[model samples]
Target: MKRLKIKSFLGTAVLAFLIASCTDILNEEPRSVYEPGFFETEEGVRGGLTSMYAHLRYIYGNAYFYNTTQTGTDEATYAQSADQNFLVMDISGRGDITPETSRADVLWGNSFNNINTANGIIENGETVGISDALIAEARFFRAFDYFMLVQTFGGVPLDLGAGELAFNDNPVRVSSRNTVPEVYTQAIFPDLLQAVNDLPDNPRITGGVTKTVARLYLAKAYLTFGWWLQNPNNIPTYPETSRSDPDGNDAQWYFQQAYDVATTAIDNPGPFALQDTYYDVNWAPNDRNSEILLYADHTETSEYYNDSSLTYANGGGADNFAVWMMTWNYTVLRSSSSNTEWLGDIESVRREAVQPLGRPWIRMSPTIGAITNTFDDKTNDSRYDGTFTTVYRSNIDVEPAISGPVYNANGMEVAGGDPILTFLDEEPATPIDYSLPPEQGANVGAGVLPGRPDFVIGPNDISRRVYPGLWKLGVYRTDSGNGLGQPNAASTRPFNIAKFSELYFIAAEAAVKGATGSRSARELINVIRARAGMWRWDNSENEERIEDNSAEMVAATPSIIDIDYILEERSREYFGEGYRWYDLIRTQKWEEVAGSYEIAGDNYGDHTPQTVTRSIQPYHYLRPIPQGQLDALDMSAAEKDTYQNPGY
Candidate 1:
């Protein structure tokens, strides 16, 4: 593929922003682009390094990229307000995931651009008196981007218009692809190994790379590469080569290496450990806690530092709008101002920039399997409550113009801070009245529970238009005074990329793949499960709920742990964080696990589910080389066709 103006923009324009605007870096007049000589200076090396960290914002927080990682997976599907971007990803015959349509392009362009910058820094950092530790940061990120790329697109070019892993000054019109093994063994493994040895234990900045994270990625890469070598399901890899490793290691050797590295990281955690409870890991107030290893950060204080408008966000690149996808229109549920009857219809749940409420796009919703199968034990497990906004409380008090107690579900009086709508954990003994009209206090087709003052929907009744919202990633702001605070603005919270809790899961998964460990797969998995059972604060009830069901959770695990069980635990632990597609792909279980899923229709209150089948063929495993790349390549049509993946 050809390096075009887009790559030039990444190298030049983005560097200027990193130098002048990034709070951690020096302040200078912003230049439109940088020259080849820039990196020769110490300032340029430092500035390019900062740009590597900033580049994450262009990928992780972009909602379209988030959809590509999820929507078609078993965790989620397209919702009512979904456009073509969300629909095509569903793979349910809405539209084909063409080269033009695939959102994986976000990963493609941004990662390559960052890789080129990394190449620039690595080449000149030592000559300019930059520290080895600082230079290793660039190495870590280079490997990081390559790891993501190899997994997503099978094989990618190591040379971006230059020699292999060399800095390219001039844009080129021709490119060649590397083999999968070559990309992993040459590009990813070497850098990660060097980064682990050269990096510091603690981060230099608030959210910088460390040896532990390096080890984590190294172990993860080894694990994923081992799976590719095993080829249990006979999945085809592009730029195809033998499944053999270049280093003469078999799949078992790599799996054991993965287990060893992961366990080593676990034993030697410098500044990282799991949070006390599962809720503490994801709760908005507890962000940047010890559990989070790395994140793409944004500040609520400064518009410049936040990288977008603090008061209003257009929801483009650098905007954390992924949480908006699964959120339904909770603002539509109404309450009565008169206690006697349902006359004054007031919107009880106003949109607020809080953990439970944010701007709802309603573009994606969870599958029934995610709710009913993966998170089956809602009573004992705290993850279900922590992951979703099950109970939406009244926020009328924030709107000072409004007054008086409002009547709800049973014509019962309620004020602010009371539950207006509750997605019930279990079906109540009394049948829910799904046919009740809006005038009779039923709204959004949600059924009414007898004598309850909150509109109720059981887990089975969750539909495309109205369902639980993703609470873990919901908006949080300290500036919302007495009114809804910047609900329309993209979230300023840092989007977490890696967590400390994943070490255990990685080790356990490696063990399941036939590597013996000091702790068995069951032992490692139970550690996460036991933590999930402990709850210090209940999000839905809006109160402190001290409960410890660790033993119960431990007892619930099957005697023999398998890959499927590990995937289930992963979904429970890291739901809605864009990890599903990779996990399913790694195990080669995408078709078996997510081939067909059940969800309700788009209309509100329509709880009847229809099974939707996806066309997840073997060739679909590797996303198509983006059409933009094909258009830029200086080659014939046949060469371009040969360059693309088999199916698309």
Candidate 2:
């Protein structure tokens, strides 16, 4: 297989036609005009493989289907749909999902498209005497797509071989949803193992799949299987009637496998390493730093390649959907040239004044306890700096000087603004008064509170006004070097988050599961905490806080070890990366913790506490398989009965 010399056969007319139709059909179909003979050579195999890769890019880049669904219910974005039904049922809390509204159909379809492409490549490549290594890469890609499918939708239609002509007419969809464990053991694991065996440890190709990539995928599959299927921790098993019958212990085992694979990848030649400074390498557009172990390498000329210019709001590129989804919040506000000082006074503003900068909306709100408890110790954590805004300004300083002409609702400068001026001892210096309206005198911003404005008020003066319309996550770039003078400044001003610090938390969890040392989990957790600039356990304040050191704390703290701590760390680390909802569900904490926070001013009109309680029901554990596929299936009574997971 390695010795096979694949050749390229490009018939002139056929090749010309492919070139003509290439741009349009590249994403949808590649085989409509080309015959099997066209793919007989090495160059042809490369083109076919490249086509498969294009599908892979599409698979990952479907931000709306994947990121929105994940972030909507997960941790970052609170569902603010105007429809109460959509907010309460589809998001906010888990509820029975109608197949019609569910987005699983898109995930299923997109994944299978990649799988089908992989199948074509594998089958045709073999016939053309393509090397075993190429075949292995194809297999890895196929297995990965399937893994995503099975995890998401339970038993998806398994298409190991190429679809037959009759597949459309008399399609035979596989019955009996493969058990999660069975899928891991039979399909996912074998394919990955074979891929690892057949692929080079470090291939000559710069960006193609390698053994390390295969290991990473395999490890993740094993870890997930261990947790959901094996239930190593002896936690309550997911009932057979559940959408995906998962065993808690199996989940633990899968996590361990993930750690092992990550460890191996770390130890491999040209091993994975953390980027030195979170701000410099990870956040910068520069890719020279190759801390990324496995990533899609898109050259500057490649359509998939994204640069700072491509991501900039004024650069005619779409704002990163991930950044937009993660950052959109009613309480966040953008600063404008008209109000430079307003940026400093976001802490005292009301929810109405907060306007989010246009970006992918990714959010994960840490519990108040989570924030306060970790605050002092983690004051220096790179993540803390990257994730939250700490500065604030007082309202008194933000009020416009009395000397400035006051502008009314219609923007006309009004004469003689109220001049009692009890707040300041000196007469107002400016004619305009930008004081807060009387209706909103006492509201505080989400994170900070404002103090007295710059004006020196009379000793008896107690009135305080805050600057409104402050956006958190407020980083931005000006349109021109002339600063805020540019007309496009406000309109084109955009801020989107790309690199998040929470992946480190996930890596820590994986490490703990795969640890060989006596305190491997603790060590891994501690390393992450340290990276986050959290205080050591021996710190005086932390010691005092841990006076009782309950098992949960002890387990989470360095003194003791528990998975719960891992979960909590994950919650903190990945707060706005859209992992919260999934983490909560996986750890069985959603119902218990969902109602703790009051809905301050949700988009859905005034939902009462009674309306927001989320109880963990078995049905919600797995989203229902899309109904469209079910409609197409020809099912006998027993087969249909046995196939669908119980709750759905």
Candidate 3:
């Protein structure tokens, strides 16, 4: 049981990664015998393990990975930044991703680098004198990296440490891609199996990876292998699809294995459970709840993200990464800035402008069309409004009292003026007939009717529009004092990686795929619903279960189960928690899943209409290997040709 104070320890790992120079330079792929002796020591082995886990920071700490996984799916789109042109790659076929794509490069480089480190520990396990538990931990980390690689860039070089390469050339030169199935069978499965056998049921430290986490990953790996085995998706790459069954991979068998492994993790009862309410899941200050299975712990000292140059000066940390997914930065009609005359009280004005949650970087936008229509029952679904902010209070006094100043539609300082605040849903009929406009000085932007002395505060001009701001992860400070060094740069929000609610979705999906039979899909989904206060399960949990609940509540009995029902249930439970894209990808519903949405105003809703049409392409199943890696490959053109992902 070693203490895993791996936060500051990760700094060493980050330093090890020289900024990947897209073409000629790649992240370090250790020379065979350069540091062999160091890994032979007990302390060295521990350091190696910590550093290996530390590479995950490059993945979770930045918005790149999150956006790579989320944006362009039916769930969300990246903001239209003047410089962020690559943002188009997520949703539309506009961007032809290549080796130079920064996202692809970091993911490919860091994943392999971590795996290479894990290989060092695993290869020197006996000499290092580290216990079996440590070895198991290392193996899980390696398998986890491969899982990401295979999912992103199909078959990557399946390199396990060879204490010394048979040929002493460059190590990463083997950018030779393997088939999708090969990465799984060779690296993911064997490594996870080693992890399952050697790791303890739970780790000694909080935030440390546990055997349960390893097992869950194993289940997902198997599920992925099984699903990808049949070539269900990847239609554009038809005959040459990366098939595995013919290469001795059993599709059905792995599905069952996925279910079995997931079941074991699910029934483990090791302090993890679903929070009774969705809000409680992201409610900071309570991050160590039962719902979160694995997360990158962020502190000011050991920050998850540290590159804020993307949004503002001094604004890069794991907290800022969460802000990237937020709808926080809309101050177009925010009371503090929107109010010039100060007609409304301070509190009401503040409430009208800001949603009081999530500092909106608006870098990534969640679509309003999807928000209104995605839910199975928009009215009954608690997540519909709870997850998105559509209605906003008006900061200005839209309607005046009897003695208030009256002005025509134009604000001409009439004696009676109405308070200029109302719900977007219940907007005033006559263009907010403000006879006298609130005197916002010329510097401030206000509305005035043409040729009319009585100026009007028109809704069309102000930033008050009915769009959904993502509030799934709550707000950090939205000002320059955002605590991440820059004002309104990043927050103290911890980025969530996995949750128990997802486990339920995994189980239900596994069940739907004919893998598990422990619970019907309805029963599993009903458990989540009862927690969200959406709908109660039929069979109520015992009094004891209720006492230990997220809100001290329990589920009732279940009903008939089906796949469609489970999918929608997932939307209700884990809307913006970074699960949508992967879910659609795995379910083979990308085409119908990502309806082409022309977001006119803003991803955070600047009162613009959104257009959604089915927009998934067959070639999207696998992202292209970053061209930088391909150019760096010592292999021939033919080799590179075969190695690039299909259709790329």
Compare the candidates by lDDT and give the number of the best one: 1
Q: Which regions in candidate 1 have their CA more than 4 angstroms from the true location?
A: 1-32
What's the ranking of the predictions by lDDT, best on top?
Answer: 1, 3, 2
Q: How much lDDT does candidate 2 score?
A: 0.40
How good is model 3 by TM-score? 0.75
**Candidate 2, 1-648: lDDT as tens digits:** 121111111222101111111111122222333344445555556555654443433333233443433433323223332232233333445433556555555555445544544555666677778888987887887778767766565555443222320011112444335455555565677779889888887644544567766776776566555455543433332223332323334455566656666556545634334454433222324342444334322222222223213223332212222333223232332211223223222222111111122332222222223333323234244444334422222121223322332322212222321111111211233432334432222122211112222212211111111111112223243322322222111122212212223233444556555535233666556645544442222121112221221233233456655656777666555444434555554545555545333232332122122223444454555556666655545676566545554566
RMSD of candidate 2 to the true fold? 11.3
- Cα TM-score of candidate 2: 0.62
**lDDT, each prediction:** 0.86, 0.40, 0.53
Count of clashing residue pairs in every prediction = 0, 65, 52
Off by over 4 Å in 3: 1-36, 90-94, 160-172, 233-242, 246-249, 301-320, 334-359, 376-380, 389-466, 475-489, 534-562, 602-615
The weakest ten consecutive residues by lDDT in model 2 span 13-22
Q: Model 3, 150-169: lDDT tens per residue?
A: 77766666632232211111
Let me know the TM-score candidate 1 reaches against the reference structure: 0.96
lDDT of 1 by residue, 112-139 (tens): 7778888988999999999999899999
Error of 2 at 279 (Å): 3.4
Identify the superior model by TM-score, candidate 1 or candidate 3: 1
